[model samples]
Target: MASEPGFLPRDGLDRLIEALRRDGREVIGPRVRDGAIVYAPIAAAADLPAGVRDAQSPGAYALHAVSPDERLFAWANGPQALKPLVFVPHELLWSSRNDGADGPQFTAAEPAARPTAVIGVRACDLAALALQDRHFLREPYPDPAYRARRDALFLVAVHCTHQADTCFCASTGDGPEAESGFDLALHEIDDGFIVAAGSDAGAAVLAGLDLAAADQARMDEARAGVEAAAAAQSRSLPSRDLRPTLLERLESPQWDAVAERCLSCGNCTAVCPTCFCNAEVNEATIDGRENGHYRQWDSCFTSGHSYLHGIVIRSETRARYRQWLTHKLAHWHDQYGRSGCVGCGRCISWCPVGIDLTAEVAALAGEGTA
Candidate 1:
């Protein structure tokens, strides 16, 4: 069911923060970190990256100062996504201890989950979160840890009124505006924010703010803001029906061509919002008195990802690149009923060599091969 929309004044931002914190939820939002906008725990409205914008391009990102009146979410996105909140980068599965007389004992090391409110979540990342829910929660053997975190998650999604050169969420059907799956969807406007609740909990939060009711004109401005961003995008995926084309082009020359420039550094997967590959390892002390089994993030681009008893199937960079692209664009739909790439363009912006996957796919599909 849909909840009513309201208008929150710029100063009223603190009221929302206090409301969530009062509910014992840790508020996470965007902030400047290491020269870029990254998500972190925020204590108050002042912690948000106000008047800060980002300039992004293939293999480059720079932060610039904007006037205070500029939108708070004037930047596109950062390397961090909603993935880390649900699927932790590193998780302890269990631990073994050597008892003095009892021989050995094993104990499960489950992660402690806190009720979390994530502010300033982008539309593209909202889609990624839903996709990950399908992979980790809806599956037959649902991930308990992911479920715990997901259940406690309260999404405060923001519409994209500003886009980077690399973003293509418009083409991917992910967003410039969110349709669902958020507790609250916000559209930042001059002097305030247009906010709508997606669930009862969000409505409860909104009720506490005592915000003014949103009129048609305010709603129109919010819609126009999101639409303007969609039209401004300069990059897009080649097609909506890209699966068959990508599946057939697995043996194309483009893979080898791109592989030559690829460093196999795993930057694409590392920054990808939808990529969820992981590897399990056992960490033990030097004396072997205690050992912990953990699952950590892994990438398909790595040479050892396909390693077997004595041989690696994808030893060559070309093969590994092909596997990664094919799995991401084509095979993922068969497994998850959706494309793995959300068109967030993190792969394009963060690639060390500026290798653009959309360009590669377009070339392989015989459209603008140049």
Candidate 2:
């Protein structure tokens, strides 16, 4: 791909935000909230986290201050993602009522309002969302709800200068730098930012912004910085041929050992960006005259998730746990041409049991069983 011109400085960002606001679009980005960087609506430049960083660990998170005074883009990934802002956790599909003599009347529920731009999206999250795009929006049977949310929103992906111990985007070939699927990509370079357009919508936003043309030297320097940060990743998985190994070791003994510590809480799948399994439930009136059906997020770890004619496929916690991990790292490639995991490590961070997928995979592979 040819290199595109970059943004000038902080002034260009202001102009872009103003443009979005003028269009009556809600401009959401990273903002400091109770010491953590979170995605929320921004009214001005001052709302962004100027110079602060977050401390992340498995089941622990905290925020701290950074030195640079004018640097507005000096924060890491937040606990919250752009998923809920787009795909609502719960929604009323439809409802009906009875008028006695007139019989039953149905009312169609309106879809979620289209959101505008989502700024400061980390590269890993963007890659995970790309995987979801293939599953929900680009598949043979497309989800209208997901399609509407995906098509209407704008994306602003940010390069991660620092990686947490839990992060393994490098292992998955997903992150540390924004590659594509972004409307605009921002890399923090000193006191300013190096912005690149990734789509036509991004170009349009850039055209209206007050950014100066990025020279060859500046662009090259910015690209080099991004590459260096990505190269400096401290954690990674040896997953080049993981799928075949995992497939061969489906009945491996390593699974039983790991399952001993697993609570089967489904926290891993809930926090995972690409795990999109859902289940439908019908709500009916006491008289059974009116009812509404709805679908909600589901997890393979849950016993009901694998329910087949009232009998669960994997009744044991060990089997259910093994099924999820193996499918994510192994079989997902056969189905989607890519591993289901983006190596974001949210699963590691949020799991109450502190079960590490990387450690499990490494142990299995080392035993010559995976």
Candidate 3:
């Protein structure tokens, strides 16, 4: 986390975790759990998923151990990202109680969130976080709860040294190497990590580690790994803006083909970091004196999402799939000035049926329609 890049030896990483905990930040990082790299509370460098390489493809993900190595942060990404840290999956909005005889009193529920530092944040997630910020922190009515959690978050990115077959962040201009939005960033090499600070807080943390300046050879080693990761990626979305391509092909038969295979289980939206749809619920007490109002994550594929006045506008999976793709690649540009997809490929890997969007896009555009 230094202004000039520094070498953080493997053991030094342990101290870095300590430094964050000392700063009263909850240290969250990648951990090997439940057969996937998931974000959990990490106390030391050993908590990282070491020597574990992940294989990712359409509808498949597996983590294999290649031990006798000291490398940590060797995997691309897991099913988790920075989304849940700030934009909570479930949250309480407010509650109303009739303690008085005259009128019921309403109280706004403030979220209790501690200062948190997350490690191993990838470029795609960072890009997704920016889009989330634009949506949640927009003018006129900013989300108070999301803003509070976001402000207390500290990001530590890891430059990708490995690319999954499903990854296309390189072509999306979001990854393989992070361009911005992290407090600190790291490039993993044989000896250790080459660390750099992108913010004052990151610099302060680096100052406590007593790291040495990264030499040219070590720096180049880390840089080369990242470059190679980019070169190895095979999947990429269409180069042009997908908005025009998709909007013009509203009647494309590809939608029906994809829908036939799609389960409409909402796995894609659930894993997508940029999806922000939520459903509100009000539960009234038995006596009717109090009511609990809550909001939780929802997906566009859900029938309730399109249900209005006893009608489901997008009742069919074909319509729902088209809506999701169009909004993610087209309408999002109108709202956030960019595409919603960060090209992390979570949708592809997590989809139970292996519906690759890249191939679907090409089909709809008539580039390679079968």
Candidate 4:
């Protein structure tokens, strides 16, 4: 890492990975997995998906290997989001044990976390992280487990020069370019990468690196590439106050129309980076002497998610589907002062029934126009 924005040759990436490891940080990054890019433990820069790209559409996703000379950051968003890394899908909250004397005693479970440096983070994921910070850190009762994982993370954000057909980050005002919330940011160019530090730790790493200073001409080329990516996005939300509009139409027939096509499989919320719903369960042995309490990710689409007093609220698929869409686009604003959807297109790409929220909202507004 240089003291300032600088040029790093392709091989510098391997050195960076080594530098993080030398600092006792576990490095996690995008790698080819089960025909898709998934974040996993990475040992070296070779673990990155160089010259790989993904084809994504509603109900479909496929990865392809491009030219060997292709840039490392050529792929767009993957099915997995940043939520799983920090929020965690499931965790033991506490365990109850009894000695031979008194009743059961409960011991709180702590988060098992390691200092981690995450590479290949995209702009939309950064936005999602910020929103999650507000919810998990700023809430009335902050989640200690989430806080632990979040505090242990070092983000390495990368600019997206490629756009997927399902992406609409431009409309969400989130991406194609990552502007903040990163320790170090990298912009990939033909010759190499333009790297800049956004924090003191990042600056310290850069100061020890053997890299050349980036010139204005190189910066200009990188800006052009990002702009081209933004323009290439074919999908976008309508330029209007979507929150108020969607709220007003809570009773719209469009909800039923969309529910007809929805599978209620919870794939949208599962892939969503900002969906924070969860449920807690208490499991006990057949003897009923000890109990294990655990928390797991839950989806609003489940029939039992809203169960209360021997009856289920939002019993119909239409109501559950409405809860998901309205909460994502409308109610999230009231709760977080921002939209939950980062426009990364994971929801669209992973949906089994190909239900696009952008299209559903368009239908509510009348001619189904973009």
Q: Pick the candidate with the highest lDDT.
A: 3
lDDT of each residue in 1-370, candidate 2, tens digit only: 2346665676556776787677667889888787567788998877788767666666666777676475675445666676666555666677887768998889876665655888789888898888787777765778777777787788888888767668888778888887888988887766467777898778877776756777767677677876766676565677744887787888888888978888989888887888877887879989978878677888899999988998999999899888898888888888788888887888877778777778788877884232
Cand. 1 Cα-lDDT? 0.88
How large an RMSD does model 4 have? Answer: 1.8
The TM-score measured for candidate 3 stands at: 0.97
Residue 74 lDDT, candidate 4, scale 0-100: 90
Candidate 4 per-residue lDDT over residues 1-370, each given as its tens digit: 3366989888778888888777888999999999999999999878888899999998899999987777888989887878998898988899998765887898999776898999999999999999999899985888899899998888898999999999999999999899989988999999888988988888877777767899999899899989999999988877424787788899998888887888889989888988888999989888877889988999999977999999999888899988988887887788888778888998889999888877887787775732
C-alpha positional error of residue 109 in candidate 1 after TM-score superposition, expressed in Å: 1.7
Question: Can you give the TM-score per candidate against the true fold?
Answer: 0.97, 0.89, 0.97, 0.96
**Ten residues in sequence with the least summed lDDT for candidate 4:** 361-370
* Model 4 misplacement above 4 A: 1-3, 285-289, 367-370
Worst 10 residues of 2 by lDDT: 1-10
Give the Å shift of residue 359 in candidate 1: 0.3
Query: At residue 152, what lDDT does model 4 achieve?
Result: 85
Query: lDDT tens digits, residues 117-236, model 1?
Result: 999999899999888988998757898888999999999999999999999999999988888899988999877889889999998888778778888888888889999999999888
lDDT of 2 at 335: 79
